[model samples]
Target: MKEKILNEAERLFWKYGVRTITMDDIARRLAISKKTIYQYFTDKEDIVYQVVNYHIEHEMIECTRLIDQSMNPLEEMLMISDLMRRNADMVNPSLLMDVQRYYPKAWDAFLQHKEGRIITDIKANLQRGVDQGLYRTDIDLETMARLRVELIQLGFDDRAFPNNKDVMTTQDQLLHLFLRGILSEQGFTVYNTLKNKEYNLTAYENK
Candidate 1:
C-alpha cells in the first residue's frame, strides 16, 4: 500500500508540479481515502521527501546499469541523453522550481543526488571515455565533469528554453552541444556514424 501510494504520487507529481499537488489530489487519484494516505505519510512534505528519495535511488541504479552496459563512452552518453529526452516530456516545467521553493527537505535530497552520486558517476564516465580515446585527453577531467553535472539542470530551466515537447527538444540540442564539445576527432567520427544511424538528426527541424 505504501509503495502504491508512492508510485501514484510520483506520477501525479511529475505531471503536476509538487507545489500544486495536494494530499487530497493524490488520495483522489489513487481512489483511496485520505485516512489511508495519512497512515503512510505524516504530511505532504513527508511524502514528497520519500518520493524524491525513491526516485533518486531508482535513477542511480539505472544510471549505473547504463554506464556498465554501454559499448563505449559515446554510446553511453547517447543512451543517457535519449533517456533524458524521453523523460523531459513527462516532467512538469515547474517541478524543480516548486520543489526548491516549497519543499526544502525534498530539495536537499535532490541536491545530494546532483552533487554526490551524479558527479561521481559523470566523473567516472569521463575518465572511462578519455582512457578509451572516445573523448579528448587534453581536457581537464574534473572541470569538464563538473560542468556536465551543472548542465544537467539546464534541461529544467523553462524560462531559458520552454518545454516544446516537439521533435527538436531543448534537451536534445543541449545534449548534442555538450557531447560535441568533448569528443575527439576520432570520437566525433564515431559519434556521427552512430548518431546518423540511431538518432537520424535530420528528422528534427534544427538539423
Candidate 2:
C-alpha cells in the first residue's frame, strides 16, 4: 500500500508536477479517501520525500553499479552522463526541478545524497582515470564531477530543449565542448574519434 501510493504519486507528479498536485489528487488516483492518504502521509512533503528517496536511492545504486563495473574512469564518467540523459527522458525533469525550487528539505536531501555518495563515486572514478592517463592530472576531480552533474541537470532544462529545437544539442556537440577542455592530446584524439562516430539520439523523438 505504501509502495502503491508512492508509485501513483510519482506518476502524477511526473506529468503534472509536484506543486500542482494535491493530496486529494493522489487519494483520488489511488482510490483512497483523503483521510486514508493522511494515514500514511502527513502531507505532500511526506509523499515528495518518498518520491525523492525513490529517485535518489535508485540513482545512487545505478551510479555505484556503473562505477563498480567500469574498467576505466573515463568510461565511468561517460556512463554517468548517459544515465542522466536517459533518466531525464524517462522520469520527470520538471518535477525534479520543482523539488529543488519548492521543497528545500527534499533538495537538501538530494544534495546530501549527491555529495556523500554520487559525487564521491565520481571523484573515485576520476582519480582512477587520472591514474590511467585517461584524464588530465591537473584538473580537480571533485570540481569536475560537480560540474558534470550540474551540466547534465542543465541539459534537461526545458529552456535548453527549446520549442524551436530545430537545432538541438547533439551528444557530439556536448561532448566536444566539455571533453575538449579537459582531456590530454591522446584523450582528445580518442574523444574526437568517438565523437565522430554515429550517435543515435534521433530516436528521442526530438521533433
Candidate 3:
C-alpha cells in the first residue's frame, strides 16, 4: 500500500507540479480515504521526500546500468541523454520550482544527489573519455563535469525557457555543443555517424 501510494503520488507530482497536489488528490486517485494516506505518511512533505529519494536511487541505478552496457564513454552519455529527454517530456515545467520553494527536505535531498553522486559519475565518464582519446585532454575534467551537472538542472528552470518545447530544444542544442567542444577528431567522427542515424530515424518516424 505504501509503495502504491508513493508510485501514484510521484506520477501526479510529475504530471502536475507538487504544490498543486494535495493529500486529498492522492487519496482520491487511489480510491482510498485521506486517512489511509495519513497512515503511511505524516504529511505531503514526507511523501515528497520519500518520492525524491526513490527517484534518485532509481536514477543512479539506471545510470550505472547504462555505463556498464555502453561500448564507450560517448555512447554512455548519449544513452543518458535519451533517458533525460524522456524524463523531461513527462515532467511538468514547474515541478522543480515547486519542490525548491515548498519542500525543503526534498529539495535538499535532490541537491545532495546532484552535487555528489551525479557530479562524481560525470567526472568519471570524462576521465574515461580522455583516457580513451575520445575527449580533449586539454580540458579541465572537474570544471567540465560540474558544468554538465548544472546544465541538467538548468533545463528545469521555467523562467529561462518559459515553454517546455523551448526547454527541450535548448537542452538538446546545449548537449550537442558541449559534445562538440569536448570531442576529439576521432570522437567527432563517431558522434557524427550516430547523430546522423538518429536524425534519419526521427525524420522517418515523424513522416
Candidate 4:
C-alpha cells in the first residue's frame, strides 16, 4: 500500500507540479481514504522527499547502465539525451521550481545527487573521451563536468527561457555546441556522420 501510494504520487507529481497536488488528490486517485495515506506518510512533504529519493536512485542506475552499454562517451551522452527527451513531456516544467520553493528536503536531495553522482559520472565520461582521443585534451574535466551539470538544469529556469517549447531542441543545440567545443577532428568526423545519419533518418520518417 505504501509503494502503491508512492507510485501514484510520483505519477501525479511528474504530470502536475508538486505544489498543486494535495493528499486528497493522491487518495482520490488511489481510491483510498486520506487516513489510509496518513498511515504511510506523515505529510505531502514526506511523500515528495521519498519520491525524489526514489527517482534519483532509479535515474543513477539507468545512467550507469547507459554508460556501460554505450560504445563511447559521445554515444553515452546521446543515449542520455534520448532518455531525457522521452521523459520531457511527463515532467512538468514547474515541477522543479515547486520542489525548490516548497519542499526543502526534496530539493536538497536533488541537489546532492546533482553535485555528487551526476558530476562524478560526467567527469568520468569526459576522461574516457579524452583518453580515447575523441575529446580535446586541454579541457579541464572538473570545470566541463560542472558546466554540463548546470546545463542539465538550465532548461527549467523560467527566467531564462520563459514558456519554452521544444526542450529537446534546446538540449540538442546545447549538446551540439558542447561537443563541437570539445571534440577533436576525429571526433568531429564521427559526430558529423552520426548527426547526418540522424538527419537523414528523421527526413525519411517524416516523408
Sort by lDDT, best first: 3, 4, 1, 2
Q: Which stretches of candidate 4 lie over 4 Å from their true place?
A: 196-207
**Candidate 2 regions off by >4 Å?**
156-176, 192-207
Q: Which RMSD values do the candidates have, in order? A: 5.1, 4.7, 4.3, 4.7
- Which is the better candidate, 2 or 3, if ranked by lDDT? 3
Clashing pairs in 3: none
lDDT of 3 by residue, 90-160 (tens): 77777888899999999999999888888888999999999999999999999999999777677767676
The number of clashing residue pairs in each candidate reads 0, 0, 0, 0
TM-score of every candidate relative to the true structure: 0.88, 0.78, 0.90, 0.90
Cα lDDT tens digits, model 4, 1-207, are 998898889889988889889999999999999999999889989999999998777677767777787788988877777666666657777888889989999999999988878899889999999999999999999999998877767767776777568666776677778888889888887787665333111111111
How would the candidate models be sorted by TM-score, starting from the highest? 3, 4, 1, 2
Candidate 1 lDDT, 11-102, residue by residue in tens: 88888878788999998988999999999999999999999998787766666667777788788888777665656567777787788889
Q: After superposition, how far is residue 13 of candidate 2 from its true place, in Å?
A: 1.7
Error of 2 at 118 (Å): 2.3
